[model samples]
Target: MVKRKSPLRKFLFYFGLVIIASIILIPFYYMLIVSFHADYDPYKTSFNNLTLRNYAEIFGLIQSTEEAFFGDEITKRNLESINTKLERLKSISASKESYLTYVEETLIPEKEKELRNMIELIMDFSGLTPENREEYLQNAMKIGTKEYNEIMENAQIILSEGDITLLNDLYYFLNNYKSEEFLDKELAKVKEQINELEEQKQKIIAEKATEFPFLKYMKNSLMFAGLGALFSLIFAMLGGYAISRLRFRGKGMLQRSVLVVYLFGGTVIMVPLYQMAVKLGILSTPFGAGVYLIIVYIIQTLPVSLYMLGNYFRTIPYSIEEAAIIDGCTRMQTILKIIIPLSAPAIVTVYIYAFMIGWNEYLFASAFLGLKSYKDLFTLPIGLNAFSQSAHSVWGRLMAASLVSAVPIIIIFSLMEKYLTAGFTAGGVKE
Candidate 1:
């Protein structure tokens, strides 16, 4: 029979739990608060500019705030193009009615001077008599059927004769006959493009490939962590079963070796693992980095998994396996059908532990993954480091990204919490 605890002892136990819980939870609460801030420092928690824009930016939901959007380099380029068109329009507007009448007296003389020079050149080319020359001049000014045909034929002849300069002047004058219509349409197209860009400021525009590869980083992290957990669980399950139940020579030594490997610090093994990865030609690639990280995680967690599962398996009586054997079950089948069912709590605990190890590992990932060139292959932690180290270091964005990255680990723990607690507290098959 167990003895009951006194009220003071129970009170201290609950009070201690509360203190430990606060110690673990306060940082997370701070992170959450900072995630919603536009610009915040822990020393100044005034809650003035709190927003979800950081999350919006991270998920590519919005390009940026309206002010930042307009201030972007692309916006500046578009503005320069628009300004060029505006300047051209200003020049073209000098010929409009508002300004034309004030300068018409001087402009008409200049125009007549050029037209007279053109008429003399046409006469020299056509070589017409006096009456024909007068008719040609009148027709050229008014653009009659005869004059139009004559000008067209003459222009073609000049073009074919390689008189490009004179032909260009003639074509320019003719093309600008409806100058307002032509310039208006050209100006309209440019303004339309500018307007579209302005509209884009209100929506998300993630076209800048150099900015952030959010989705790629998220996917790589999930893949690396998920696979690491799965493979680690598989190997740990087999190894734990063998250590706990199977008979073999040097088994104690093998168990000791596992413990030693788990106890080995990452700093001690980093250089050797890196050299191995280099030799294997897996450096800088997603597969190479992921596999290397997964292997390290498996080695790291396998010892704990083996120890916990071994102890759990010990509590399951050998009589159960013998009973299964008498019922014609193979050794593998007995382990699978009997041992696994009894060890679910421990398995879940180890799996969650392995996943967290893989997900949160930063030192080796940064050292081995070659993050500079292969940034898209970055895990969340590496990406976060890169983000924080960038020139525009927005703490709010960093906090938001950190919060989002931690959500998966939190969810995994939440789902497996009961199993983990059961693994710690419950023993098996006591008579």
Candidate 2:
């Protein structure tokens, strides 16, 4: 029989654990807070000042709030001016003459201008037109049937495809300017637009998770790491099976030396690997750089993968394979249908380990993909590092990118943690 811990000891143990956990979590908390910041000012803790513009900027959505969604100063001023006049006209409950006079003089001109500017900004950002921002802004100032048609077509596309909800409402509001009931409809639409804009703003803020470059980098990373992990697992399974099952000359030496790749640090082999890549012309282009990275990742992961799976295959009872052979299964079929199924835990663990190595490898990735021509092929780690070193580097955005970069690995490790534990210790188990 075992005695339970006293209440005081229990409290202390839990209290210490809480403290340690808090310490570990503080940086993540800081990252979350700063990612919502409109600008980098750590001392400014006012809830009002926090914003999700950082995330938008990452996507290259708005160039200035660090980006915009009908949130720019000129747009804000125009909106305020029109809304004020609209309110005044509504409150007065004036006759047609008075209402028409006020609407014509104040609201219609600004609303028309607002519509034009809004469309131009929207189209420019949508990148549907070959025209640049300045060109589009200039075009936005002018209005013609051609411009209106283009705006309607492209703006429709933007509304259907884009995040901003205001464009549709704005188009409707501006269209109402042409109707006689436009005066009455104007007040209601403005209120609806304000509420809708606020809602859309909140939604965008919530999704401000990764930047545009990050998407491309993530794709590169996924391709390199994902393919590397898959092939490494395949080759490792083959090699590991041979080593564990078949008797051959120098088998013991081969088993012992399987981990020789890890004996010297990766740095020691970097020069040799670099020279090999250069000689093989694997780094000749960006696509070639990717191929090179994948090959290197396989090599990096294969030794341990082979060793782990070899041992784990040993833990799987030989009687199972014998049974498969007796049932007319081929040797390959026995390994696949029998060996692999029983060794699922070890297989998953080794695959994840291989993935982690490729996913997290920064040194070789940067070294190989660091050329200016290969910028698009830069993996997440390399891209994040470049962002941090750039002139526009902000702590908030950097932290956000770093956090996003870590998510895939965190999720994988969390899911496969049990397999990892079982696989690592399975070698010690006797049949």
Candidate 3:
């Protein structure tokens, strides 16, 4: 027989859904509206106007200096080239004797000797023997006065090229290249400009930093939600299987125990848990804190997870497991290959629930992670609190951060809600 759902029930369900949705969306809407507001004074209740200046400032697009765009390499290369030119000028100006010696060694050797010999022959032209004169005349043109004159001319040419007047001037006045008064005036102006720009950038960065905390908090919320869902699914599947298939003693007691744990509040054991964490040195570092928090979350989430999965497992027929065994399958195989596939919706529901519990948890996070030095180790809740306390709290940026953090979770839930509901209801209905 098919049974139709009552219209009153449908109306109530939709009404409840609407209320829940509003509860979730109102804060986000408020944040989005505020993020567009330009007035930054936290004490002032009213906003002056909406502007993109705050966002631009945070991103370093507006009022940014040219220096910010340039890398260190360009500056370094310029400095190096300047230094190299300075060193070359200094070397040239340091020793005139060394410069002359270089010229003598390089340019005067072959030409000077030949030219001196030719000058001797010209002066002794009448007294020279025929053979001697012939020998002198033959070699004279090749290695004598004419050759020496040519070499001297070449040396003059080389010396003209090697003239150090420009280099000497540069070396002598390198220190005074820029006048002190001029440099000081230019430097002051540049510093003043930099200071103004830096101040503006700082203001924008401060606003954006405030927003980052809330965004981080939102991520923490999602992480916890996902973890909770996973734990819940495991518990639901295992617990359901045990109750449905096993003929164990104290089954009723076990069921009641699971319920008792679920009913147990986290506040009751907060002190002891804190002490245990301290003793174990879990409070010493961020990683330790995360470990402690995960443990606490697992303990808190286990019971409900077990109950949800156990209930789901109970709804499946025992005949299916028996049929699998008859088909030469092991119990593990039957459960993995048969039962789990059928209980997908229930598993998904448990996973989602567990994830939510972990994601939303704040009390334990705040209490246990009270130290300020380990603030980075803190979850989203702690980060949000820190953001709220900072000066120049721009509500718009905060809202932006909040929205960025939340949109993912909302999307995931919206897509999976149908499957999760189906799993939950399937576990509830048993033949």
Against the true structure, whose lDDT is highest? 2
For model 1, the superposed segments whose C-alpha errors exceed 4 Å read: 1-26, 39-47, 64-210, 213-215, 414-431
Q: For candidate 2, lDDT tens digit of each residue in 89-197?
A: 4554445556566667777678667766677566666665644655654454444445556766666656654533555555555555556777666556655665665
Model 1 lDDT tens row, 112-230: 56765665676577664456667666666544466756765675665455554654454454435346775465455545665665555333333432355566778887877778778
Q: Where does candidate 2 stray beyond 4 Å?
A: 4-8, 38-50, 56-212, 424-431
All candidates: CA RMSD in angstroms? 11.3, 16.7, 21.0
TM-score of 2: 0.61
Q: Write down the lDDT of every candidate, Cα atoms only.
A: 0.67, 0.71, 0.59
State the weakest 10-residue window (summed lDDT) of model 1.
201-210
- lDDT for 281 in candidate 2 is 88
lDDT of 2: 0.71
Q: In candidate 2, which residue pairs clash? A: 62-67, 64-67
> lDDT score of model 3?
0.59
Off by over 4 Å in 3: 1-29, 48-221, 228-232, 418-431
- TM-score for each model: 0.61, 0.61, 0.55
Q: At residue 273, what lDDT does model 3 achieve?
A: 87
